[model samples]
Target: MNAQPLLEVRDLHLSVRAPNGNRAPVLRGVDLSLARGQVLGLVGESGGGKTMVGKAILGVLPDGARVERGSILFDGKDVLAMPGSARRMLSGKSMSMILQNPMTALNPVMRIEDQITDVLRLHMRMDKAAARERALEMLDAVQIRDPRRVLRQYPHELSGGMCQRVVIAIAFACNPALIVADEPTTALDVTVQHQVLRLIRDLQMKSQTCVLFVTHDLGVVAKVCDAVSVIFAGRIIESGPVREVFEAPRHRYTRALLEAAPRYDRPETALHPISPALREELTQEIVHTYRIPGHAV
Candidate 1:
């Protein structure tokens, strides 16, 4: 028998309160799985529920959002069924998130040393001295220079790339089993983005951790992900090994997304955006599949 997946999401249907007091579906029966030490990419356009999937797994959905049905299982335990305290205990210790914006992710007023050490202290129960030492080690692991100096500085004192590195360091401080990286490289330039990607991949390999890398960039997925899932209108329409799916996409939407991305080999080629008719078809399909009246697409 195959070993159980590290993470499994099944028939997850979530909704948020709309302005008019109606619930709008955000995740429509979305299902996916991630094995230990694997990097799975969740790629889709804006407002396609990519980030929502990550949020649901982490149990950090917005205030107005609710999981109407389905389950999220981490390490064979039902995360959605766990109590608040149980979920909180699992969060920083076994599962952590690396958000899109490092500036907002890190507390501006706190020193870098305190930020990293706090998680180590809380999760690992390290004493003050031990936490401090481990914090420095975490910084060095992320390729930060002059770790001691950086420890004394605040978020504002570091460059954007450095701040992101610090955030990454914090996320990995507890050696969590799973990480949900939501567009972690979107805020950086090309060179910095590549470096951050490499750093994340290296650290993941060393730790043997699973990652749910959520991004709209196919290029980033191609570089870092072992498997790929294509989500559209809150549904996973296609998924498979990266090489197989990229070379021969079975879904029309998947083909459209691949075509939409820019090619390095053919720099002269113009981009082709997804057409409106396809979007409408997908929207209708979602409505038909769920058969729920007044379900927002």
Candidate 2:
């Protein structure tokens, strides 16, 4: 492992404007680090601010969202402090994202070739013919059959799995240093999800690209991630190596999550859902720690 991490997020505090025009804290002092060639899984329940961490790193936070404090350092440079042009230049070429839904991530009307080639042309500075050829190669790299034909087709013409493959291809097209994959397999079926996970792991290994995999699935994290961070109520309560955390989780919430997740090996075991008391306790802890007025965890 590299001594210096490829990406580092330190004490990130974020707030989003609520309907009443008040800023509600979304991410409360999030700290994360991903070394080179590592896959770090951000695991948490929905709305726990997992996706916001990725968005903050990508500089693509939605309207009304603001990062109030802390810095995101990528390759020793603070991305949060970078100029707009520098950040924009670094985003597509040095870093990229594989979004949750491929259908929505891709343009509906654009042909596959154009979508893939556009990134290459813009970031890699490839000419038309070179970009087109590279696009075909990328499609093939993602194991898409009949790359030439698929390139001519629109996103709607492809299966969900195929569309995801295309998105993965685009994400890896520039050989980016880091990729923030936010629930990339949530929209796919079990078999396809397995395939996609394997594909991502394989590509990450081949290119040695660091990845921040954001997902709610512990099973997925076990299979794909080297390290895992458990987020709750806008805070990372527990984080460590996958085997260590899974076998001996330190936090109550981490243990509760593990118990709640279905285990194929223990089919007869009863599922234990997280209790409301625990949720309330964690929320109270957050409130006490931050002392943010009117903040809803």
Candidate 3:
């Protein structure tokens, strides 16, 4: 690991306003660090506050959600403390995000070329012609054939895989220092998933870009991650290099995840869910540890 990481989230706490005038805690004291030129996998079950961590980092928390405490530091600068104008400038320039759903993330009314070129023009200050050329180059880099044709089309006209490729193009277009890839391949088929994963890895290697790869799939984590963090009940229970954690997971929750995941090599292996008792115990511990005053857990 590098002595200085490209991105770091320390003691992060977030809450969402419920329908009945209540705030429910989502993330509790979550800490993560991504070293420069490395992919750090955040593996956990769904609804475990994994996606919220990424949103918090980008300062894009959803409606009724707010950051209660903690700091998001990118390149040793405190993003949480930055002024609104400065933070807006920092987004998509020094830091960018590849959302899970490409079509929803993109504008339905805009053409693909216009969408991509907008980023280049806004951040790089390139002229329209130059931005268009670079956008085409990026599409080609992501292995999109007939880049000209695709550029003219909207998100609805392209396949899910192609849309994902375009999203990746936009994310890497500016060569941002850090990328938050929140399950970018979850919607694609196995073949497309493989290709997208390969594209991300190749781009990261070529540019030395740091990535926070968020997913529940352990198999994908093993394939592309340099280091892995196991998040359970909004807490990071265990984290280390991929090989070390996979071979010898310290936390029982981590071991449970590995046991539950389907393995192609072990065709007859039975999948076992983590014990309910253990899950309840962990949940209670989190509730107890992060209990806020005047707020029900």
Candidate 4:
């Protein structure tokens, strides 16, 4: 058994070259480590490179983006240095991702049965009937009541929440040692988000799987993550135990992100936008017209 960290991302510097050949560094030497059975939360605003970090570990960079430096080690081996064949072998059964958009992740043309069976066949070497049973069981495990019908249906037939759950079911069905969930509840209604999150937590505890949860919602991070990292401008400016960060934020960015989230102490108007000049300088964005300057909205 390997006692090494399940996933260790060294000073990872990632960048993208635009069509005009301008280079943009999205992740500036971001470092994170996850041992087996731990959960690490990456929180930040949109375009802050939270998702990019997760994708980098999965070897799925966006168009034009490349990992300029650093190594992602999983179970004591460098993921990038491994052969493509070895990485492919390690993905589904060892590591998997629950993408932010289930509609895009699941195939519209394929039945859910076939979609899951593909994993079983290619990764687990299971026969058709066994894979089919496992796929249905997986649906049930994720709390999809109509497991059989769902297995026979295409992704388009399911609601967005259902589709997201299906994505979770498929990704988590085989108990991969590590799971990278990018906004695991983005598509669900507010009511179902908790259920989905609870499902992830329950499964994580059961499987002792390390999870790197990426989301812009600090509320979600508060509910799930054991440890949290607050990212800004592609840098982890603050990080610590969830309780400590929530109670006593060390970084100004972290404090601002929390103060921006609705709070009982703050008056409702605290969310009003600050002067365009102030925001532009802080976030490099001109569109945040309603956020109060000292805190968040």
lDDT of each: 0.92, 0.92, 0.91, 0.81
Candidate 3 residue lDDT tens string, 51-101:
999888887889999888889898899899999889988875988888888
Residue 71, model 3: lDDT of 90
Question: Native-vs-model 4 lDDT?
Answer: 0.81
After superposition on all C-alphas, the RMSD of every candidate to the true structure, in Å, is 1.5, 1.6, 1.5, 6.2
Per-model TM-score on C-alpha atoms? 0.97, 0.96, 0.96, 0.88
Judge candidate 4 at residue 167 and give its lDDT: 87
Residue pairs with colliding backbones in model 2 are none
- Could you give candidate 4's per-residue lDDT for residues 97-199 as a string of tens digits? 9987899999999999999889888778899999999998888888899788888899999988888888888888777888999998987788888888998
lDDT of 1 by residue, 152-202 (tens): 999999999999999999999999999999999999988999999999999
lDDT of each residue in 145-262, candidate 2, tens digit only: 9999999999999999999999999999999999999999999999999999999999999999999999999999999999999998788899899999999999999999999998
Q: Candidate 2 at 66: error in angstroms?
A: 0.5
User: Which 10-residue window in model 4 sums to the lowest lDDT?
Assistant: 286-295
Query: In candidate 4, how many Å is residue 6 off?
Result: 1.3
In every candidate, how many clashes are there?
Answer: 0, 0, 0, 4
After superposition, which runs of candidate 2 have C-alpha atoms over 4 Å from their true positions? 291-297
